[model samples]
Target: ALYYDNGTFFTKDLPKFQPYEQQANFEYEERFKRTEGKAPSGSARKCHFCLHRLNAGMLPACVTTCPCGAMYFGDKNNPKGLAMQLLAFNRGIRLKVSQGTEPRVYYLTSEVGTADNLKACLACHGA
Candidate 1:
């Protein structure tokens, strides 16, 4: 859920039982200045699940280059896929389940320290 307010871009965070948190404030103008006043297409600066790569039968860049091997991608309905196996084994949860959007993304819960560590790494690595 990326949005533009004034010249800033941000995304809303979804928690299991808490209110949505607005996270990741980024300057729209500074980030997209090269476009020279043209509006960007698609979901602004958000991920579109790498449709181009997926159509080409390749993994998304994020999944392929994840330093910690934390990301996985596969057909959700495929019983033998690693993503499905992990989701079932770990009891993965999806965001905004009540919305009935049936989002394909699933998250596996982790310790607080593990999440903090990942955040630090992403901050430094520009993920």
Candidate 2:
């Protein structure tokens, strides 16, 4: 799932990277043996609340990075629900979607917008 980004430059050669994937799997096992029982990815701790999804509210990075007040984040169950409102605004349009193992990140963009360029750029530029 991590290796399958549409915008990643290496997306075209992913099959050729299979051996490295196997090597990573082996390295993980070796690291586990060395550490007894610890995450091979390393020891980084996040806030407890940050670990859980809080509905369609502001995701972590968006909340932190928005310099302007353009981005809004909150629960979707409000009388003015953000998620429902946004979807309703696009009722007739198609929404491209993908299922990840457990996706905690969401991007809101349209085909005609800067988002489209971003996706294409990622595919060829290793974003």
Candidate 3:
């Protein structure tokens, strides 16, 4: 059913944002230049869902590096697809629903106590 549903056009620049903090982000840029001997492209860059990486038959950076197995990806049609099953089971919700931009990315609702490594710091601190 989902496979037959036509999806919107996907592109690298659909989502855009202004440059973030100079100190925080620029630190990464500086490190990249020091380690890799090349300057980063610009002051800021947005996530493109790792289009080039996907094209190269590799997983996205976030999904690959996410700790605690939080990220999921794969073909939705496959019965064994983790991403599809998680979404189909209603454990995940789409972001920016009102914008009509249906993204494949999903944030799982079933997972609990992820913040601060499941520690109730706020509750204990009486905040």
Best by lDDT: 1
Candidates in descending lDDT order: 1, 3, 2
lDDT scores for all predictions? 0.61, 0.41, 0.53
Report RMSD (Å) for each prediction in the order shown. 12.8, 12.0, 15.0
What C-alpha lDDT, on a 0 to 100 scale, does residue 109 get in candidate 1?
61
Residue pairs with backbone overlap in model 1: none
Q: What is the Cα-based lDDT of residue 28 in candidate 2?
A: 19
What TM-score does each of the candidates earn?
Answer: 0.57, 0.29, 0.49
What lDDT does candidate 2 reach at residue 36? 19
- lDDT by residue (1-127, candidate 1, tens digit) is 3233332223223233122222322233222221212233423565667776777789988998877677899997799999888777675788888999877888776554667757866874777
Q: What is the lDDT of candidate 2?
A: 0.41
User: Clash pairs of candidate 3?
Assistant: none
For model 2 the local lDDT of residue 17 reads 38
- Highest TM-score model number: 1
Better of 2 and 3 by TM-score: 3
Model 2 lDDT, residue 12, Cα = 37
